[model samples]
Target: MSAPPDQGHVLVWQEPVQEAWIDYNGHLSEPYYVLVFGHATDNVMDAVGIGPDYREANDASLYTVEAHVRYLDEVSAGADLEVRSTVVGATGKLLWIWHEMWVDGRLRATEEILGVHVVGGGSAPFPDDIAARARELLVDPPEEASGRIRPLRRA
Candidate 1:
């Protein structure tokens, strides 16, 4: 899908909490949370016009260099999950994104991601059109995207 003309957050992906994804604790497993977030990232890539076809055509793609996820709540099986994503920023070869995962209208998780555009096995500038579209969708990062895991200080 092409980038939406609107310049704000977008609902990029949705899926149900599958039975197989449940853990012994009876909630969505930790890895599954990352899996869903990854799917949302892929959708965001598609929106910005760098999906599989683009990769195959140009031998270039966005490679996630770093990610930070906060799993805030439990998700039960069968719950419908949706991810809202924002293009926090983008440059010639780097993209920053924030995603919030929602279940039953409640915020369940958030992930901050940094991806680098790669061509021929090294970082490279994004194609002009793709960069333009990503810029059009850019928005300020949310409060949750502090880019740090909460500090751990114990007495």
Candidate 2:
């Protein structure tokens, strides 16, 4: 199948680094990287009708199965950063998403996340309605929006 549209529409979430999130090196800690990305994922899910309410109604939830993040720069304590995410790919119950951390329009990091649909506790196939909603939001980065990084690849 052909790739989805590279619309490059960035969903911006703003937050400042708290004292607890700082590391010995005087920057946001490594674990918080996933935390910020997780927040971004939740935003994207809400946009696509897969938020907590949807899960509660459908008896399904999306869980991250794998996440790969590359830290290109350091974010200092008290610094405000924005986390942006886009849907890269989706099929069956799996979704491949890409996220970036930005400070003042400069990219600080990039993350590739793989999420799976789950029911109760185990892996479960995506229902038709949810799949359709996700497909509607599946997006590709436009050439101008891609910047220096390549498009997200499937796992």
Candidate 3:
């Protein structure tokens, strides 16, 4: 998919919460949130021409270097989920992405990720065309992007 016409977030992925994703407390589990966000990342890769097809042809792919995820609200099993994603920034070899998960128009979670283009078991610059396309979709990072977990006080 191409960048949104107004340079806003793109609706990158959609899926229902899986039954197995629910935890014992009867809500969507933490790891599953990351899994769904990872799928959104894959969709973003596809949008910028670095998907599985490209990986097969070029022997390269993008790998996440870091990620921060916030679970804003509880989600029940079988909820219809929609993920909106933005290319917050891009360079020759790196991409910064932001993703929001919405259920019935309510924000449930958010994720920010940094990824690097990798080839031959090491980081590498993206092909010119792919880099240009990624840059074309770039938008300003969200206010909450790049946040870190708070440290705990010693007892």
Candidate 4:
């Protein structure tokens, strides 16, 4: 899965919405969204050669420094979900990724993530090969995360 076959293409990862992930209201739970996005994240990581092999060989790993998610719609159990990720930005030590969650051809959610490469305990630059491969997949860096201010809605 190193860097995927097509770096410029969307990395689509698909999975079913699990029944155990449903909440009392019968929709996907808050935490499960994070977990599914994480599955996509792991796919991206493996693609960029930062997986278990890298961890074992280089003694380096990634840590989620920050993340932002917007829940736009509900996802029910038994629905098939697709999470597509595009690398939006990256540096020697940091990777910025944006993900869209699709259900039935409709966009259901979005997640933006920032991960830092860690060697030992502190952040360190990514390996040259990894960095170069990721650069090929880069997109326009997103705007800085702004604190959201929710407006009143119809009740």
Candidate 5:
């Protein structure tokens, strides 16, 4: 139920695919994956002690400034999905988060985000403890972390 004491939390968000999330084409819609991955990012922020209390107390919160989502496969309504998040790294005010959405035992989508810490309406450094821990867990960003989504062109 929890990661070993030596390691930080293994961030995960699991939920059932909602019918309302399906689009007219009858598959999970592009925006819905963003919604689900957003939830996962919330969980990650909370686990790192940047949750509601932190915001209310410090007036600091993480804002996603950039995001890249890859729709790798299709998911249907009622399918079970899980999102796993990794802390890629952190600069003074920015934290990079990576998420993988899985369904039916396969990777369905991925989202990589640039998260900035804001305090009193301006970008600020992440707390020392959070930065240290996140840096420790940081690995090289995933291979897919590069590139933008674009229409496939003829090779």
Candidate 6:
């Protein structure tokens, strides 16, 4: 499927591995992978204007309902990694995102995330405006992965 015209707005976050993130094998620790992806998700949310302030103003925030990650390569400590994210799809209360982590132009990992907007006071539906904004950022799933689209599998 083709990417959305405003795909340039998709966020890219670059981070370098720290000593603390390294394991005895001299590679990034397993847990750090999730941590890094979490940071990348924050960057994407900020780019779409649904960041901290927006959540406070609207009394709503995005929550990760599920995430599927595939580690393709090892990234050693001190390696610089780039994370690129795109909104694969979005509905009234759900969002599907794809993230790729690359180190020195080589793919290291890929993550498919499912999220939802919930009211700050409770787990309720998001307001109309927030839902509309999310829809605008949604895009068609990649052609090869078209059949993979499905409801999130909560971790």
**How does each model score on TM-score?**
0.88, 0.80, 0.88, 0.86, 0.86, 0.82
lDDT per residue as tens, model 2, 1-155: 01222345455566677789999899989999888888888777776667888889878778987777889899988888787777777777787777888887788987877788888888887777767767776667434333333433332
**lDDT tens per residue, model 3, 1-155:** 12233234464588888999999999999999999898888888988889898999888999998889989999998798888998877777888888999899999999988888999789999998898888777777777875432111111
TM-score of 6: 0.82
lDDT tens digits, residues 94-149, model 5?
A: 88888999897899999988888999999988888877666666656666875432
The CA root-mean-square deviation of candidate 6, after full C-alpha superposition on the true structure, stands at 5.4
Q: What TM-score, to 2 decimals, does candidate 5 have?
A: 0.86
Off by over 4 Å in 5: 1-9, 147-155
Q: How many backbone clashes does candidate 4 have?
A: 1
lDDT of 6 at 89: 73
Residue-level lDDT tens digits of model 4 in 14-47? 8888789999998999999999899889888877
Question: What is the number of residue pairs that collide in model 6?
Answer: 1
For model 2, the stretches where C-alpha displacement exceeds 4 angstroms are 1-9, 141-155
lDDT of 1 at 101: 89
Best by lDDT: 3
Tens-place lDDT per residue, model 1, 1-155, is: 12233335574577888899999999999999999888888888888899999999989888998899898999998888888887887878888878988888899999988889999899999888998888878777776776452221110
Give the poorly placed runs of model 6, Cα more than 4 Å off: 1-9, 143-148, 151-155
lDDT of 6 at 63: 90
Give the Cα-based TM-score of candidate 3 against the true structure: 0.88
Model 4, position 140: C-alpha lDDT score: 57
lDDT of 2: 0.73
Question: 36, model 1: CA deviation in Å?
Answer: 0.6
Could you tell which candidate, 2 or 6, scores higher by TM-score? Answer: 6
